[model samples]
Target: MPNAANESSEGTGFQPGDGVVEEASELQEASSADRTPEEEFLAQMLAASGATNLKEAGLYDPAEVAAEEERIEEEMSPEERQAKAEHDALAAAFSMIRERSNEGKLTTPGTWAAAGIVPDHLIPVDFSDLAFDEIIAAQAASAAAKKVAEEAAQAVVADADADAVSADSSVEDVAASDSKADEAADENAPSVDEGDSLDSEIETPEWKLDDIKVLEGKQTYLYSSDYMTDTYAHWAFLAEEGDDALTLVDNAREESRLYPRPMLAASLSSKPYYWNAEQIEQAWQAVQESGSYPDINTCEASNGERYFYSTDYLSDAQAKALAEWYSVERYMNV
Candidate 1:
């Protein structure tokens, strides 16, 4: 058995496993004290370098490690200091230039100064190394473009003035021709007094014409549809009751003729009439049932919606064209 009094004073009251820890701590303290500064530094370096063992300790060269650091107290000469300051200034200027260039602003020193980014002292350095030539060329090109736009605008104005003069001349010529036509018509027309005198002078006719004179006019009458006249009586009877069905068909026919376009049945439910959904559907059904009107045609779109147009007002070709135009222009948009 070990005697309590015989234990070392430094490791008094040691537990059963404390003897190994105490010995290790004492050995480490003794080793640390015996080591010189270089050895201590080398050991610290070894730890910092993450050396697992002494075999990997060649990661540092001890010869390069000086015992003492040497720093000369000689101040920088004016030229050297100025050169260092210029280098720093140039670096700062280039940094600002690159940053502004990335932001799509002009990279000139003047622009930088206006933006309050570059310092006044940093502006006078060597910026010739930057792509100033390219910037200048771009500016010159922009000026040239502006000049060309101005010239083109002037040319357009001149052409408009010439057109105005030509239009004035044409209007004057039309006025002169109209004046001559009016004079001829007035000379040929029977005045009120002359008509009265002729009635008084002749009981019947003094001369008989052998040939009839034909006046030149348009070949076709405007909006003259045989189908409209044929269908008018039926439409008139249906519209006499002021029914929405007749109104729908009447508007479809009239507007289709005037605008030369197909009319969507849905458009009838909006504005000036404001028919409800049921009313519009009822009117549309009535239009389909009325077989007396053969010129009424309906086109069904891809979405299974029907639009109505009247062939009484439009030819077959015109109605087809209008349907196609409405499919792209109105139906697709809606």
Candidate 2:
């Protein structure tokens, strides 16, 4: 007989290393060949998913995956990162869709179409169930409300016009009454008498100096410079003569620097008594003869008031005459 093992192998058609192991080896080789295409398809899917690398898709070892993830993150442009973020958001939304679909809360497009509830983008929305009758009722109510408001406004305007007419009538009546009252008052007023008028008898108050008296034993009068030297002194002497003749003399003396002639002239002339022409002439002559007559320029009266004139032309006799004329007392106390 041939070798028993060889006889059995020949019966089974088995050769050395040509059994199931060889077949398995061949299958592994074919799988290896298919693996390249499968890997390429997976890479394309991952690219479409916006995964940066196999590591992001959980296809690499932990250490290698970490390195790959870092490399992918580093290598990605800003735009790529943005795109990846959008893809992630879309994936999350899809995941939510899937979860809701699984939970029966959301229906698929096929289901929606079968139920006659297609998306508005794909089909015109049907509003058959809408309550159009209620909308019509609301519109009618709005129109009725607007009409009521207009009617109310018209009523208010009519009322306001009536009130304005009444007010205007009242105002006209008031004005007429006031006019009548003014006319009545004018008719009832008393007439004034021309002869007995207050203006005829009322004497104007004169600004005469008071409490003026000659100091004894002093030929020349003395007075406070500041008190009598201003424009008011001239005004006082020019005012109407009064009982205050001495006061007028004092004022003039003070204003004219104690010039005796000007002081007396101002005092006598300011007296209110009506002197005759002869008396006036006599008074004037006395003033001319006064020894203390002020110089011409300083002696001239200004604003109708006598002031001490300043001049070199005044003679001694004229000065003496002026002083004597002014010295006569116009009023004497008994």
Provide the overall lDDT of each model, using Cα atoms, as 2-decimal numbers.
0.49, 0.38
Clash totals for all candidate models = 0, 24
Off by over 4 Å in 2: 1-59, 107-334
lDDT of 1 by residue, 5-118 (tens): 222222334223232333323333456677777656655655676654333544333222221111111234444444444444444544554453333222344443455543
lDDT of 1: 0.49
List candidate 1 segments past 4 Å from native: 1-241, 329-334
- Per-residue C-alpha lDDT of model 2 across residues 215-329, encoded as one tens digit per residue: 1121212112224333333333333223233333344445345443444344444323344445444544544566444443224322233333223433445544454444432
